[model samples]
Target: MATFLFDKIIFGPVKSRRLGVSLGINLLPNDCKLCSFNCIYCECGWNPDQYDQKINFHPKAQVKESLFEKLSQMKANNEDLDVITFAGNGEPTLHPEFSEIIDYTIQVRNKVFPQARIAVLSNSSMIHKKSIFKALNKIDDNILKLDGGTEETIINLNQPVGKFNLDNMVKLLSKFDSNLIIQTLFIRGEYEGKIIDNTTNAELEAWISHLQKIKPKEVMIYTISRDTPSDNLEKISMNELEQIAKRVDAAGFKTQISS
Candidate 1:
C-alpha cells in the first residue's frame, strides 16, 4: 500500500528516535520482499510468501547507482546526514552485492559528508558469513538485533527458518571485534490462537545471562515502535522496559530506553 515509499535506491532522511535523522538505503527489490526472519514486529511486513518475496528487484548495480545519485543531490543541497543506513523493506543482507555496496557507500559518503556515520540495522541472520562481517566491520554503529536470548525464545519471537540455530547465531555475533550494540524489543501478546509472551521472569533472566557472555558495548531495549505483522503482538510497558534497562546497565554496559 505504500507506493512512493522511496525514490531510487535511497529513501529517507527519516526521523529515527535512536539514530537521529537517518538516510535510508533499501537494497532489496521495491516490488517483492525477501528476508531471513519473519519477525512479529516487522514494519515492512513478512518476506516472500515462503520467506522469499520473489519480486523483480533491481540488480545490485542499479541499486548502487540509485544511492549515488540521491547522495550526490543531498551533498549539493548541503543536507545533513545523521547516519547513512542500509535498511529497506526486508533483510538488507539478502542483496547479492552486500559487501561491495557497503564499501562503495563508505567511499562516496566520505568524500561528501566525512562526518556522517554509517550504520547497518541487521537481523543478525547472515552474520556468520565472512563476507558479511567484512562489510559490517566498516560501520560506525554495528547495531545488531538479538530479540530473544534463548533459542526457544528466539525461534518464537523471530520465527526464523526451521533450521535457524540461535546458539550458532549468537556465537557468530559475539565474534565481532567492535563493541556490538544490541537492540531488543520486549512484548507479550497472542497470534492466531497462540499466546506469545516474553515478559516472564524466567525469560528475562535467560536473556540477561545470555547477554553477559556476549558482553556488548551497549544495549538498547524498548517496546514495539511500529505495527508488527502479527496481530497478537503487544508492546511492553515503559515501566517494564525501563526495569529491564536497569538490569542491563547494572551488568556494566550502557543501556538506553526509547520511551
Candidate 2:
C-alpha cells in the first residue's frame, strides 16, 4: 500500500516541474489521505482505509502560525520561491477554514516574499460552494483537476464521492471565466481487470471539447511523475504528451505539457 507523501503542515521549497520552486501547504491531516476522489493514481494510496486514519483537520490559527514560521525562516536564509501551493495528502478546498487560510496566506506571502504566487491545487469538487469559488478567485493560481470527460471515465479513473457529474463540473468550471487553469492527468494501463487509458482519441476529443467550453487561461496536461498506488498503471511519455498538447494548442487554448 502507498503512504502519504508529506508529514508536516509546511513542507518543501521543492523544485516543481510546472510551478518552479514551490512551498507546499498541507491542510489535510498529516497521517491520512482526506480526499473527495479515490483516484487510482493517487500517491497517497487507496482511500478505503482512510477513515481509520482520519485525524483532526489542523486548525486555521495553527496553520498560519506554522506557515509564518517557515516563511520567516526561509526569508531569513534568503531562499528563492516562485509559488506557495496548497497541495498535500488530498483535496485542499475541503478544509473548512480554506477561505480564511487563503486570506492569511496572501497576507503572510506579501510580507515574506511579495513576488511569490499563491496557488491552489484543487480537485474542483468543492467549487460548487459559493465560499470556495469566491476564495479561489482571490488566488494567483487556481488550478483545478479535470482528469476525464465522460461519467464512466470519471468514475473509472477519479471515483469521486457524493453527487458529482461532468455536466455540473463543466458548469462550475466555466464560471471561472478563463481566470483559472485546467489541469489534466493522462495515464494508461489496467485496474481490476479493466483497461484504463485517457490518452485515447475518444477521451482526448471529449476532453478538448470540455476545455473549449471552460476557456481557461491555460491548460496543464501531465502524467504520473512518481510511484502511484496501483502497479498496473503506466505514465504517458513526454513525446505522447507533446502530441496531445499540439492538438490542444491548435484549438486556440494555451497549453503546457508537464510530463
Candidate 3:
C-alpha cells in the first residue's frame, strides 16, 4: 500500500491544487491514521493497526501552543499564506476537542495571518452532530466530500466503517443550504474482487441530482492525484475532468476542476 501519514501535529505550508499555499493542522494522533471511513483512494493508507490504543491524541492546549508558534514563525519569516487547512492523517472532526481547537486556531491565525482562510477538508460523516456542524460553519471554506450519491457506491468507495449511510449524509449536506463547497472525486478501477467506478452514467446522474438538492456554492470536480492504497485505481485525465465540470456548470452550479 502507498502510505503517506503526517506524523506531526502541524505540517506543511505545501502547495494545494485547490486551496493554495496551505498550512495543515492535524487534530488526530501523530503516530497513526484514525478515520471514520477507510477510503480506497486515501493517500494515508489503511487505518493503523493500533487503533484501540490511539488514546495519546494531542491535548488542545498543546495543539494551540504549537499552532501559535508555527504561525508566528511563519509570519516573522514573511511567508505568504492563503489558507490554514485542517487535514492530515484522518478525519479532524473526530477529535474530542475539535471545536476548542478550531476556536483557538482562528484566534492564532487572526493574530498572524489575518487574511488567510480557515479551511477544513472533511468526509462529511460527522456533520450530523450539531456541534460539528456549528464548528464547520464558522470556517471560511467548509469543503465536504460527497464521493457517491448512492449508498452502495459510497460503501464501495468510501467504505464507511460505522452506521453512516448515503441517505443521511445527503440530508446533512443539504442542510448547508448552498453555503458549503461540494468536493467529489471521480475514479474507476478494482478494489479486492469488485469493479469500482463512480463515473458511470448512473452514478453521475445520481450524484448530479444530489448536487442539485444540496445547491452548494461551488462544485469541485477532480480525480486521483497520488498513490492510493488500492493500486489498481487510475486517475481520470484532465480532459475528462473538464467534461464533467462542463456538465456541472450547465446545471447552474459554479464548478472548479483541479487537475
Candidate 4:
C-alpha cells in the first residue's frame, strides 16, 4: 500500500468527510512524519527512523506568514472555508510553540474568516501537557483520537512511541467536560500477526464505557478510508460503522459517522 504526506506548510482546503471545506495547517516537518503515536492506519505511513534524520518543525513565524498569505488569498478569491484544521504529516501539537501557534491561528481566523471554525485533530498524546491542554480547550473543535478502549488494544493499534498510559489519557479526556469531540477509527485486521479488531461487542462495551466517562460533546466514528502503511488492515463498512455509532448514541452521546 502506498501512503502520502502533505509536502507544504499550508496544504489544502480539501473536501474532508468529517470537516467541510478545510484549510489545513502543517506545523510539522514538510519532509517526514513526526508523531507521538505510530498507528498502522496512518495515511502518512509509519513513523520513519529519526535516528539520523533531522526534524525541522515549522516555526511559529513561518506558520503565521504562510497561513496569513493563504487565508488572505482565499478571502480575496471569495473561497469557501468551513474550518481551519491543524492536521498534517503528524501530530500538530508536537510543535514546540503549539500553544502560541493556536493563539496565532485563532487571531488569523478571526481577522480573515471569522465564520470558519478552528480545529486540532490530535491523537490525545500531548493532552497531559498543561500548555497543550489549554490550547486544545481554546479551539473551536478540539477533536481528539480514541481509537480503542483497552490499553492492550491501544498499544497494539496506535503503537505509542514513548511513555503512554491509556487510563491517564482517558482521565485527561474526561477533563474536557464535554467540550471536546472524540474521534474513533474502527478497524479490524491482522497487524504483525496479531488479530486487531476494535469493533467487537466486548470492545464496544469497554469503549462506550470510556466515552461515558469522557463525556465528549460528540463521537465521530469512522474507519480507514485511505492507503495505509500496512496492507493487512480492513476498513469497517458503513453498516458496521453505523452499528458502532448506534452503540455510542445509545450510550447517551451524540454521534457522527463518516463512513
Best by TM-score: 4
Global fold similarity of model 3 (TM-score): 0.97
Off by over 4 Å in 1: 1-8, 50-55
Q: By the lDDT metric, which is better: model 3 or model 4?
A: 4
lDDT of 1: 0.77
Q: Rank the candidates by lDDT, best first.
A: 4, 2, 3, 1
> Positional deviation of 96 in candidate 4, in angstroms?
0.2
Q: Between candidates 1 and 3, which one is better according to TM-score?
A: 3
Best by lDDT: 4
Tens digits of per-residue lDDT for model 4 on 78-184? 99999999999999988999999999999989999999999999999999999999999999999999998788999999999997888898999999988999999
Q: In angstroms, how far off is 111's CA in candidate 4?
A: 1.0
Q: In model 2, where do residues sit more than 4 Å from their true spots? A: 1-3, 50-55
Predicted candidate 2 versus true structure: per-residue lDDT over 12-97, tens digit per residue: 99999999999999998877788999899998887655376445788999999999999999999988999999999899999999
Candidate 1 Cα deviation (angstroms), residue 152? 1.6
TM-score of each prediction: 0.91, 0.96, 0.97, 0.98
Computed on alpha carbons, the lDDT of every model, listed in order, comes to 0.77, 0.90, 0.88, 0.92
Look at candidate 4 and tell me the lDDT of residue 127.
90
Per-residue C-alpha lDDT of model 3 across residues 1-259, encoded as one tens digit per residue: 5678888888989999999999999888777788999999998888765567437778998898889989989988999999999999889999988988888888877888999999999999899888899899899999999997688888989988788777778889999877799999999888888898888878888999999889899988889888889888889999988888888898899999996
Least accurate 10 contiguous residues by lDDT in model 3: 48-57
Each prediction's Cα RMSD?
Answer: 2.4, 1.4, 1.2, 0.9
Comparing 2 with 3 on lDDT, the higher-scoring candidate is 2
